[model samples]
Target: MNYRNLFYALALAITANLGVMAQGHKGPAWLSNAVFYQIYPSSYMDTDGNGIGDLPGITSKLDYIKSIGVNTIWLNPVFESGWFDGGYDIIDFYKIDPRFGTNTDMVNLINEAHKRGIKVCLDLVAGHTSDKCQWFKECASGDRNSRYADYFIWSDSISRKDMEQIRQRNSEPNPQASTRGKWVELDAPRGKYYQKNYYVCQPALNYGYANPNPANPWEQSVNAPGPQAVRRELRNIMAFWFDKGVDGFRVDMAASLVKGDPDKKAVMALWQEMRAWINKNYPECVLVSEWSDPKKSIPAGFNIDFEIHLADKIYNTLFFASDDPWGAKGKECYFDKRGLGSLDYFYKKYADIYTSTHDKGYVAFPTANHDFQRLRTGRRYDLQQLKVAMTFFLTMPGVPFIYYGDEIGMKYLPGLQPKEGSRKRSGTRTPMQWSAGETAGFSTCKPENLYFPVDTENGKISVAAEDNDPRSLLNFVRGLIKLRHSSPALNNDGKWQLVSDHSKPYPMVYTRFVDGETYATALNPSGHSVTASLAHLGKAEKMSLTGKVKYKTGNANDKIELGPVSAAVFKIR
Candidate 1:
């Protein structure tokens, strides 16, 4: 064959190989061993003298994030929104929040992240928009002719009185912004009308669901809901940004999109349609549903659903609920007292089990999120306890998500609360304390100008001080993430079995096996030291605080002693 023909043949072979890699059989090449770090822009760092975390702040920290072996970045929404809403109540779908950075800054972030072979997934809040969003503003203006009227779910009166009946019967809060019931109160009559069924500021979208009909007017008419018109508008919003080159999206409140119908086919269809659109254009795009319910399938058309509940089950059970004085009460059984879960269970249930998602929240074990409390301030983060928690979350399966300054153990201060109250609720959301420095490096602005104050004691603790301290949690996280990346069994699908048969209080142990290879991991959750057997292994390479340890011909009687909150992984041969 001629040289050109030979070259073409080689190109075809390479394409085929890459296609196989993308099939996710051996797992997607991007994710097989990827570790993701979640950056909350508001608290990550302050550049430009603003206390709020910004793109430049993030850009400055890229090297630090990468140093720990993280290969992916899942940013919490940086989109334009009212400041206090945690970026989830987006005002504009396409614009980055000014407080965070400019669109150019985001593009720069994507560029830098890509240079290191890291994928970037931004959070998408599709369920509702800030009342300030243009769509909501137009719908509120009472202009029936407005193109955006149907973009959100709004009704002058009950289209489905039956649902209203149920709402009253169950004492359930109205799902709509104007509705009067459990949580929302209708705005007082303006002239003659008091609109019911709406959030004061977050108006819900109709999502094309009509009362009992289960079909909206736009979707019911022939030639309506076609890919070209209304749906096109929504698709355009997504495309506008994906074209800017994001790897994927983590769709917010995923289940709420389809909660109106009993069958849920409408919501499923919408997701599938969006997935198809993405496939046709952005083929590498990963769509993650924040639905949390694993039972909710993606119709074989969409790629992934967030495994939130799976992690919830594990995190709540393994350490948080079991260790805290709160024990497990009501929903507390599913979440820690601080509303996060234990580390061990999260690894077992979802780590490798989930094929695609912006690293399950469990792996990262973010103590503070926009919606929840920071662990440091939540009555959870004792210095030793913090060390132990970090040890478990960092080494377990999936990408370790770093929530801003969590590495340095920055925490929320007492008496400080977010839009929602509770120290645990707002702990991690406080400003980053750069040093014992003034205002903790959050903002040069007067403390009153800042959205949240720096925790006087634990707030925005700096990497500067922690970076040099080998014993600091930040250093510990760096070590664990590096260690996890080095392990093929822990990174991928290793057969995992719980070692629950042990006779110990609060210690956790489990073993993972693949082919003849096995990794047995044990955790001592209790305050006291304890010993456990490595009886499951025939032969194993064990890991301890000191160094690589090993065991051979293990039997039912084999065991290892563990320090309080300490963990070990033994590789079986």
Candidate 2:
């Protein structure tokens, strides 16, 4: 062959291989073993004594975060917002909220975090925007021809009379008319009603639905011009942050984008398109969803989907059980020590999700997020209970997210008035108790001026107090994270096999394998000693164990005895 022809052929072959690699990409390469720490920015710290946490405050604590053995940090919404629904009611996607500092401060935070080898992920609220947003303002200006008129869902007309009729129909006790509801009406110029996602201040963005009808003209189809325009705008918002060295986003209300999408096929398609664009342009940027359905979200291009605090069926079985004093009605969690919790629901669901998306994405399990009560809340207050809970959290198959203050056993305060749309959850969002000082070392602001009150109970939990205690929960978590980072068998991609039957009570056992090494993990969170047959460990050599618990290995085919509230990790040869 001629030299020129040979060079062209080689170039073609390389390009084809690159295309193949891109198509086969499962997820971000860095996420497989990453340990994430989630920070509620407004409550994490306060460096300038403004009574609130900001970017500079977070930047100043990079060392502390890195010391915890977390390599990735997920910051809740920092964008400019009206603070109606925390920071989720974003007014402008590009501007950082003045309460949290300027754009320059954000840049510094990303730079400082990167210096310590920590990746930063921002919270992206894609499903809605504040009613005060410029786009909404323009759309509500009484002109249907406005440039952003279709950016949000708007009814053509719903007069007071129409609303009264709707209310009358809703007031009727007939079960057939149960779905009837009311939409908020806008004043004069707008002359229409708009759909809201949560609070009245937050309006739902129009992403188009799977089906549209004459009765609901506002529900545009997915292929409509308005939906396409919104998609472009979403891309522009993503591109703006990606240029600033942000690693990725934890999308809020990710699965609820498409209105009236019962099966979620249309919303999934939207995410799939966005993921394709992200993979082609910014391949390293990860997309983590708030959606709990990993089977749908992973295939739709999310790198991870959290099973956060929601209903009883999913995560409640592990943490928020029926006996929880927090007033949530649900079955007992396996970690509750009540012996009423079952592993059947959790194991079956996890196994199904793992089988579907183990190679493509992960199902992140957090210690406790801002939306739920902390692990140390309610009746599960003992340090040993937390230790056993941490064992399961850190050893899970997916990436582990540690909510700020959870390591030190922070308690969820009760009976605090609502703030920024946090009702009962407001207690969980209290300022971090850094020390036992008068203000808990969070800030020097006056007691009344503080964003939220610190836990002032006689025996308040604090990082400083925990630091001095070698066997503290904070230290235990640090050790677990270090072990996870060092051992291939405990990382995200390790093979997970259930070693104990789910029907067993008290002790739960599982094994992780990687690179020809097997790591066996056992947890007994109850108050009584439990014995379990570990014939599976007969052929293997025992390695090491951590925690304050006691355990004894019996004969090859005999049962292994674990003391009350104990956990152990053993490497088998």
Maximum-lDDT candidate: 2
User: Which stretches in model 2 have alpha-carbon errors above 4 Å?
Assistant: 1-25, 157-182, 188-191, 323-327, 456-460, 538-558
Candidate 1's C-alpha runs over 4 A off are 1-28, 141-145, 159-198, 210-230, 297-314, 318-368, 377-379, 419-424, 446-448, 456-461, 502-505, 544-553
Per-candidate TM-scores read 0.77, 0.90
RMSD of each: 8.6, 6.6
lDDT against the true structure, each candidate: 0.56, 0.80
lDDT of 1 at 150: 54
Candidate 2 per-residue lDDT over residues 1-573, each given as its tens digit:
357645654554455335325745467778877999999999988988888988888998899999989999999999999997789899999999999999899999999999999999999999889988998898888677777878888786766776885566556764222334436567636546876666667778888877777687787876667777888899999999999999999999899889878888778777877877787788888889988888888777788888866522468877886756343565567777665677888888888878888777788889889887888877788888888889889988888999999988888887888888787788889998888766788888887877888884543588888876878888889888888887888899888978777778657888888888778788888777777776646444443344333444556553556777788887766
